[model samples]
Target: MKLLRNILFTSTLLMSAFAAGTAANADPGRFMDMKKSVKAPIGHKQFCQDNGWACPRESYDPVVVQLNEELWQQLIAVNAEVNRRVKPMTDNDLFGKEEHWSYPVNGYGDCEEYVLEKQRVLMEAGWPKSALLITVAKDVQNSGHAVLTVRTDHGDMILDNQIEAVLPWYSTPYRYIKRQSASSPVAWTGIADTRVTTVSSVSR
Candidate 1:
């Protein structure tokens, strides 16, 4: 009788552990539901391969080169536009318009909106579908927001509307959670620091 009770307890614990693991790994279908919620495309496998610190590309296609150059130029233009538009607004202005910022729009957007818009424009400009990725992070103040990361042959560069210069990802202070990929749902390797939250977005 004692042996049977022990076996049953162990089996119950194991089953509970398995169920928890499955839920953790299951896809949440966020991409399918939020397809139109954001502008970028759904497929992100190639983007992950290209932007990862380790991958290498042989050479850029002529078309890719042209598109990259054009997109680079456009990113610069958009950064300038965002700075011009958002610089004057006080913190209260942003808080007051938080609802507008949350909704998707064709034109006119806040910081995150500007990033998403720029990402879409870059994709349309001919940059490799994988070259542009939308990264959502908590700002220094712990506010949730989005930014654009451009994966280049050398490394990933950040195009932030808050700053005119495009800096490398490591240079920025924002803590990374999970980046949106074209091919798969978001993944979190680890948090940058204790302040950074684990990825809260659902996988597709």
Candidate 2:
């Protein structure tokens, strides 16, 4: 009787462990990629006004403003703000799990989703589309990851959720991969290094 009871208990424990593992693997939130940017048409006058100049201005002429230095400072400040908001979620917390209720840091987001959110917030804060670049690369671990690259006059800086401090692109261990254009909404074009295979629901 003792032997039978012990066997039954061990079998139950094994089944419970297997069920838990299966549940984790079956989670639906694991596959959501990042959201793509939306584009809308703008009239010539609206475009010009949005750009803060006349429509027929010279193509390559720089905008003449008195506070160019101050504008640059403000851009830097906004970048810092974005880093502050996203770093905690990416670095300290586990992937695909919410950390806090107030901030509501998304718990189950993949790398692409994180980048999308960061780009969206920065755009809302008035950063130019040209200033932000979405870069896709393989990290040191050879796992796929996406990060935001901020192009400045100095150099390109990477705002990764994996680290708190913003570092220049060349300083990181990631290999250089193709960057998503600020002007285009396409999720991918072609990679310079490796051929990427994108899978869709229909493929299955």
Of the candidates shown, which would achieve the greatest lDDT relative to the real structure?
A: 1
Error in Å for residue 186 of model 1: 8.3
Error of 2 at 161 (Å): 0.5
Question: Per-residue lDDT of 8-100 in model 2, one digit per residue for the tens?
Answer: 354345435444222222222211122443222122123235444212232232122222455445544555665555534442354333321
Best candidate according to TM-score: 1
Question: Across residues 4-50, which tens digit of lDDT does each residue of candidate 1 receive?
Answer: 34433543454354442232223221111112223222223343344
TM-score of each: 0.48, 0.45
lDDT of each: 0.47, 0.44
Pairs of colliding residues, candidate 1: 43-182, 43-183, 44-181, 44-182, 44-183, 45-183
Off by over 4 Å in 1: 1-74, 82-107, 182-204
Q: In candidate 2, how many Å is residue 109 off?
A: 2.4
Worst 10 contiguous positions by lDDT, candidate 2: 195-204
Which 10-residue span in candidate 1 carries the lowest summed lDDT? 28-37
